[model samples]
Target: MAQDADDAVDCGMTVGLYGRLRPYPWTGGEGGADDGGEELRERLVNLALSRAEAYDWYAPAGLRMRGGRSAHPVPDRWFLCDQGGADWTVGEDETGPARELLWMRADLPRRIASARLPLLPMTRTASDALHRAGDFRLAALRAHLPLHVTAGEADGDWEDMRDWFSLAAPAPTVTVRCAVAVSGEETTPPAWRSGGTAAEVGAVWQTLLGEAVTVAPGAPPATSAAGGGVRYRPYLEPARPVAAYRCRVREWTADAAVWLLETAGEALRRTGHRVPVELTAALA
Candidate 1:
C-alpha cells in the first residue's frame, strides 16, 4: 500500500515563529506506527516543543492556542533541523496536548511587505530554505517596496504593512522576481552528496546573486519581460536528496507578488488577459 502524506497540521499563520506556516507531527512512519492516537499526538507535540527549546533566543519557545482547544493538531511527517541539533516536541498539560517547533521571527516585518523569489534546494536538515531566502529577498526589495500610509517601525508591524499593500493591489501575487536553478554535471553523483550543508548553500546562493546583479547592473531593453533578464536558472542541487529518496523542489515567490497577482489575475481572467507568469516558475 502507498504511504499517506502523514498526519500533520499546517498552520499557515503569516506571523508566528514559522512565519506564515508551521507543521506538527502526528503519526510515525511505516516502522513507527502507534496504536494509541492521542498518545501519538502527545508524543509529537513533545518532540516539537523540545525542538522549540533551542529557539528560546528567537521567540517564545513554542506556539500556544488561545485556549489549547485543538484536539490533535500534530502531523505525521516530522521536520527535523540540525542547526544547534534541534528537534520538535508534543507534550501534555493539565488541560490537554500542545505542539510547537523552533524558528526565527526577527525579520518578519521585512518579510510580509516585500517581493521575494527564491530557488531553494531541498535537504536532509530542518533549516527552512524558504525562510532563509525570504528574509534575504525582503531586505533586497525593502527600498523599492511600496510604503504604508500609517507606518510605525517598519520592521515589526505586520498588520499595517499588509493593509497598506492590500490597498495598492489585492489578489495574492508572487512573481518569481529572480530564480537560480542548480544542477550537477556528473554522469553519476555520489549516493549521498555531503560536500556542503544548508548554511553553505545559503552562502553560495547569496554570492552568486551578488554576481548576477553585478553582471546585469544596467536595465535591460524595454522589451525585456523580466527586467535586465530577471528570470534566471542556475545549476541547483539534484532532484533526489539521496540515491532513492526524491527531494522536494521549492520556489520562493515574492509575498507581495503573490498578493498583487491574486487580485489582478482574477479580474483579468474575466476579460481573458490570461497572465502567463503564474505558470512559469511552479516550484517543481
Candidate 2:
C-alpha cells in the first residue's frame, strides 16, 4: 500500500492519508459493541484532530478541519484535510446500521503546496537505491528539482538536509518553465505526455496550469524545433521581475539537466531529439 502511494506520487497523483474505524468486538467487555460506536467515533475524531494539530505548521492557508458521513450509499469513505472549507459532522453510514464503520482521509498536496513547493514524485525503490549507493547529492538534487537551493542551505550536508527535504517545507519561491519538443516537431512536453496523445497531453497541461492551453494547428520547421522550442512559459503568478529569480532559474536548470540525463536518460533518448548539453552547461 505504501509502495502504491509512492507510485501514485511518482505519477503526479494527489494522495491522502486514509484509515478505517470500527466498533470494538462485543466480548462482554466494559462497553459492548452497541454502546462503543459513539465512543469509537469520538476516539477516531480525536485522533484525526490530534494529527491535524501536529501537522498544523505544514497545513495550507485557509485550511479547515472537517468530518462527517459520506453522501454516497455504497462503501462510505469520509474525508478530512488540513485545507479546504468542507465541514462535515460525524454521522452514521446510510446503508449499514448507524455508526457501524467509518473512514477518514487527509490530503498531502495541500500541505506541500501551502508551503510553496513543487511535487517531485519519487519511487521508494529509486530512493532506496540512491541511499544504498550513498548518492545523497544526486538524490537531493533530484528531490528539489525546478527549485533552487543555496550551497550552504541544502547541498552542504546531506544528512541534515534530508529531514528538511522530507518535510518539503519552507521552499524557495521559484517556478519551473518547461520547454519540451518531441519527434523534431513542436508538441507537448514530456512531463505532460503519457502516451503521446493530444488529449492526454492537453489534460495534463490543464491540470498543472489550472487553465486550458491554446494549441495552434500545423507543425513548424525542424530547425525551429531543434532544441525544445518555447512552447509556453508556465510560471508562478504575481511574479516579480527580480534578478534573483533569473539566477535561481539558471542554477535550477543546470542541475535539472544533469539530473534528467543521469536519471531519465533513456526516456529523453526515446524522444528523438538531441540532448541540449551545451544549453545545460552554459547555465552552469
Candidate 3:
C-alpha cells in the first residue's frame, strides 16, 4: 500500500513538471529575426532566465527525480552565442565552443515562463508618440492610404479604434463556472466524464441548456515580442474600399485585444510596473 502511494506521488510529480523545461526559441536557426538580431538574442536570454526564476517560485515541493534531485538541473555557467553564430554545439569542455560565456544558471523553460525580459517602456514620451502614430495611422486609413506606406502602419491603435473597428475585435473573454444537478444532488454524468475533454463538456452543457453553444478555445496569455512591438501590416484595396478595408480591419481587431494587452504588459514590465497582490486579485 505504501509503495503504491509512493508510486502515485512520483507520477504526479513527474506530470506536474514535465513540460516546465524548454529551450529558448533563439537557440536555434528557426528563431532568428529579420532585424535587430543581437537585441532579440539578449531579450531571449533575459526572458529564459526570468522564466527559470518563476518556475522555481511556483514549483511544487514534491517535484523531484527518483534520486530526490531537481527534475531540471541548472548549470553553474552557461554559454550564449553572441557572435551571430549558430546554435551551441555539445562538447566535453566547460567553455565548449560557444562565443559568449553567460555565468548564469541555464533553466530555459522556467525563464521563458517567467517572462522576466525587459521591454521598451511606454513612458510619457513613448505613450505620446504611440498616440500620435495611432492618430496618423487612423487618418491614413480614413484617407484610403495605400497599403505600401510602411511608416507607422501597424495595428497598434485597435484599442483607440474599437468603436470604428467594432467588427474586427473579438468579444471579451468570459469565464463561466456552473454545477450540474441530478434531481436534488449535483453530479456529472458518465457521458460528460467519458474522455473529460472540453468537447464533451460543451455537448453536455448544450444539451442541458437546450441551445447550441459555441465552444472556442480561450485566448492564451500573450508573450513579449522577441525583436520589437507587435506589428502587423495593413491590407488596403482602393477598388472596393469599404468592403476590403473592413475585412482587413476586422481580421486585425479580432486578435487585437489580446495582442495589445500583451504589448502593454511587456512595456509595463520594462518600466518596472509592479501590481499589488490584493489589487491583482480584485481586478481578476
After superposing all C-alphas onto the true structure, candidate 1 shows an RMSD in angstroms of 19.7
Go through the candidates in order and give each one's C-alpha lDDT: 0.24, 0.24, 0.22
RMSD of 2: 20.9
lDDT of 1 by residue, 1-284 (tens): 54223222222111111112122232432121243433433443344334443533222223334355422211211122222111222223212221112221111122122222110111101223323312212211111011111122222333343354435332332333321111233432332132342233334323322221111112112221122222321112232111110111122334432332222222222222221211111111
Could you give candidate 2's per-residue lDDT for residues 1-284 as a string of tens digits? 23322112111111111111222244121243355443433444454344433433223223232344211111111123321101111234412112112222223331122211212221122222222322111111111122111011222222332333234333442333222232212243333243433333333333222211122112222332122212211122211111010112212322332322222212222232222210110121
Show where candidate 3 strays beyond 4 Å: 1-35, 55-201, 204-284
Worst 10 residues of 2 by lDDT: 238-247
TM-scores vs. true structure, each candidate: 0.20, 0.21, 0.19
Q: Model 1, 6: alpha-carbon shift in Å?
A: 23
Cα misplacement distance, residue 42 of candidate 2 (Å)? 3.6
User: Candidate 1 or 3, higher TM-score?
Assistant: 1
Every model: Cα RMSD to truth: 19.7, 20.9, 21.1
Q: Compared with the true structure, what per-residue lDDT tens digits does model 3 show for residues 35-74?
A: 4444444543454334434433332122335466334322
Pairs with backbone N, CA or C atoms under 3 Å apart (clashes), candidate 2: 67-88
